[model samples]
Target: MKTLRKYLSAEGLIKSIYSKFKKIQDPKNRTGKISLTDCLMSCFAIFSLKGLLQAEE
Candidate 1:
């Protein structure tokens, strides 16, 4: 049950981060304009999800 709760939390957090990523829009911004903060956040989220998957296994 604890593992299930952790998995759900991680999933929800990842989904929220992805939603925020999708919302980023700047017509004048170039590919180089990607926010470093967002990039780091996404990396962290991916790592967290990977850890959670390993835990489940």
Candidate 2:
């Protein structure tokens, strides 16, 4: 439990969550066929992963 808490804090999980919401609120690319929300969510996840990588440094 301690290790989990440490990981979450050190990794900035809260910032990542907010970033996900921000992405959802933005517009998508020129193609409107795909769901913007879905695309944004995926992008947010990838961004969060990158953030985690940076945080680990």
Give the per-residue lDDT of model 2 (tens digit) for 2-55. 444533584567556655565664443445665655666566666756876576
Tens digit of lDDT per residue, candidate 1, span 1-57? 344453357666666676676686755565686575477575665566677557656
Every candidate's CA RMSD: 8.1, 7.1
**Cα lDDT, all candidates:** 0.64, 0.59
TM-score of 2: 0.31
lDDT of 2 at 37: 59
Which 10-residue window of candidate 1 scores lowest in summed lDDT? 1-10
Question: What TM-score fits each model?
Answer: 0.36, 0.31
Candidate 1 runs further than 4 Å off: 1-8, 26-42, 45-57
Error of 2 at 41 (Å): 0.3
Cα lDDT of candidate 2 equals 0.59
Each model's backbone clash number: 0, 0
